[model samples]
Target: STIAERRPERIAGLVYLCALLQPSGATPADLHRHDPDSALVAAIEMAPDGSATSIRPDAAAELFYGDCRPEDVRTAIERLVPEPIGPAMSTIDTSAERWGSVPRAYVRCDRDRAIVPAEQDRMIAEVGVDVVVEMASSHSPFLSQPDALAAALVEIRDGTA
Candidate 1:
């Protein structure tokens, strides 16, 4: 969603999710259509604050283990936390002027299997980022390439890229 639509209080920067970018009114079922073999609809129990209190086993397995190495996936699953995602948050307008005004960066996970490289590239092109950094890792780069991800964040923060 546009910053104006979701969190208008902030300004200047944007960190778009390079993994999955869906159109308005698109449901989780659409992801399954995109990748029937790997994309699993996560069974999430929502809390009062719009965060997921729990993710079912099947969902977790598909999300974290599908593309990552066994050992790395285990670490990510262990550290996974409740992610805040409201229903309205999914309906983003990429064409909105508010989104276009902000400086943005895209981190492309080249080895990501959850969101394939082609899909990531398509989103990057559609969203229009100021900088693009390629990470030779899976969807969960924080688990597979923490130091590199940190460095990319630093570079983006410093406007060096």
Candidate 2:
């Protein structure tokens, strides 16, 4: 059963699935042809300030914020925090009832190397969002193009988009 099927309650407001990589009925391995582990930064040690630190800074930059500047990448790495990547989060619910009734928008990052444009397109097509906004940014648009992201969010919030 899907969330919608189980809950059967309409969402009060809009939902934003930004830079989504995996669509319904797909996995991260489906997007990356090769071993996904190889692309991951091997040593993500925790800093004294409780922030995540990457030993392979270059690789992390390329993976997370490919469109960001060198200085921005350094700042992002320094401020990075640990995040959970659980199996349930990666899994997508294809049930129409749960997702179809909700108002949703997608923010596509064109230069996102982590998710890639093709995968993003697949999700947009499969899930079917109310609005589609494009940004010339990497995976981490919040760091690369925060202003644009904020504008899009505002538009969605105001229902003017």
Candidate 3:
């Protein structure tokens, strides 16, 4: 979204997959704070220096890949790494003439624990999109429902979603 907003002329459309879709001037952290049902914030472990955050490995499966295969979950957990706090907390800057003019779409995950369904709906309502596709998958749909995810992406790319 930020990239599109910054260089709308370079991109054709925007497709967010169970992502933090905030309005201008609002950070992703801001949206996560309002989602009381989301389990992601609670599972996050901040570094002592507060420069990074990590999800507890034990909680990873439930929060990110609830519907994924056990093997996939194990693989993902093995590759887990601390995420820098700066980007996650950065506020998005957009304008009606740029971001708003670009066609936007969202692929919502109904079983997501990371972003939660209500939070996803809130974001869709807060920032209107040209398309909204729902899936019976978790936050990590790539691991849980790759086929469906791919199909949705294809439809979005084809402008038929």
Candidate 4:
């Protein structure tokens, strides 16, 4: 959404896949903090120097890959890295003239723990997407349900979603 807002002319549409969809002037941190159902919030560990944040490794499965295969979950956990705090803390500036003009779509993961279903619904209601494709998968649908995710993306691209 922020990217579309900043470069609306270059973007054809916006697709959020179990991703952050906060409103203008709202940061990712702000949204997570407000969402009581978000498992990620409890798992978040700030860096000692306050430069980055990472989830507790032990909480990875429940927070991110609850519906995923065991091996896939292990691999994803192995690949996890600390996310810089700057971007999550930065508030985006959006307007109807820019971000609102682009057709937006959301692929809501019903089984997502990081961003729970209630939070997903709240964001969709607030941001107003053109379409929403729900999946009975985890937050990492690309790993757990790639075919369905790809199909939804194709549908969004073809304007048939």
Candidate 5:
């Protein structure tokens, strides 16, 4: 289903369901990922490194706003990003607006193609997040550097990163 444009709060309900998916004892695949803290780390560790090709827009119009569409890049975005149209980055707004009410942490991927440092910084400051960790890898550093990702997540977990 298409997002009911502008109905941002429904996204939270979605997140709640996501968290409940793994309520204590569940299979790894059946499990949900959750942290009571609203700390959000876009973990740009694997942010896209943008190719020179034309791109198709992800559901987020913001991503395709200022670029020309190269047929190949357009093909890539469509092919690469799976659906359920997850991540709901649209939910990022909900997380930011409620930052003061919950702990917020951010991990910015140094080589993220989707989010360069400047825009990422703006988002951090705008949200007044509690912590910001920079990981020096493209969008999916967790895949390539689980240790670092684990370390960062631990810091967020222990409140000592």
Candidate 6:
């Protein structure tokens, strides 16, 4: 769904989840799933429409499990779950918030399909992210650009970026 189309509660909730995914095996794909340990999935369960959630895997699990399909975890999770909104739900207001106070530093994958630069730009701007470094690669930057991604991490740790 378009970010603009989602209810405010959902939007605000997603921000918190993004922060959660940042630390918990936050590969590009991991940040977008419905894992039990995932902050995003937690937020979803708390959402009014989330009572129908059935296959929740812990976000920080070493490996994925349960009845979740690849599509259910990342791209079309809401589609996979049942809805409680009845015929129609009200649009959410603008009270969204992410779960972060620190600045963000990224090892971007220039060729990423799941997450593009435009979307990342918006996310960083909204989250007040302070550092960003891009690299040529696919959605899985660690796999496609490990050395560059690693260097960026070192920079983030050393406060050099």
Residue pairs whose backbone atoms clash in candidate 6: 8-92, 12-96, 36-57, 37-58, 37-59, 38-59
lDDT string for model 6 (1-161, tens) is: 12423333343212111122233223433434423344433433433544443334334121221223454335433334544532122322221233342344555555543444455554556434456666665444443345776777777767786
Ranking of all candidate structures by their TM-score, best first: 3, 4, 2, 1, 5, 6
Tell me the lDDT of model 1 at 2.
48
RMSD of each: 4.9, 5.5, 1.0, 1.1, 14.8, 13.0
Q: Native-vs-model 3 lDDT?
A: 0.90
Assess every candidate by TM-score: 0.65, 0.66, 0.96, 0.95, 0.45, 0.40
Q: Residue 11 in candidate 5 has what lDDT?
A: 34
Once model 4 is optimally superposed onto the true structure by TM-score, how far is the C-alpha of residue 141 displaced, in angstroms? Answer: 0.7
Q: What is the lDDT, from 0 to 100, of the residue 143 in candidate 2?
A: 82
- lDDT per residue for candidate 2 within 1-161, as digits (tens), equals 14543464755444443444355676543544433454542434445664334345556777787878889988987876555444423655556656566667778878876666676787678657788878888778888788888998888878887
lDDT score, candidate 2: 0.64
For model 5, how does the per-residue alpha-carbon lDDT over 1-161 read when each residue is reduced to its tens digit?
Answer: 11212444343222110011121223322211332221122311232443222223443222322232355335535554422323332232232233234454677765554455554565556434566777775445544466887888777768786
lDDT of each: 0.63, 0.64, 0.90, 0.90, 0.41, 0.41
Q: lDDT of candidate 4?
A: 0.90
lDDT of 4 by residue, 1-161 (tens): 77898889999988999898989999998898767656688899999999999999999988888878999999999999999999998999899998899999999999988998998999999878999998999889999889888999999999888
Off by over 4 Å in 3: none
Clash pairs (backbone) in predicted model 4: none
Better of 4 and 5 by lDDT: 4
State the TM-score for model 4.
Answer: 0.95
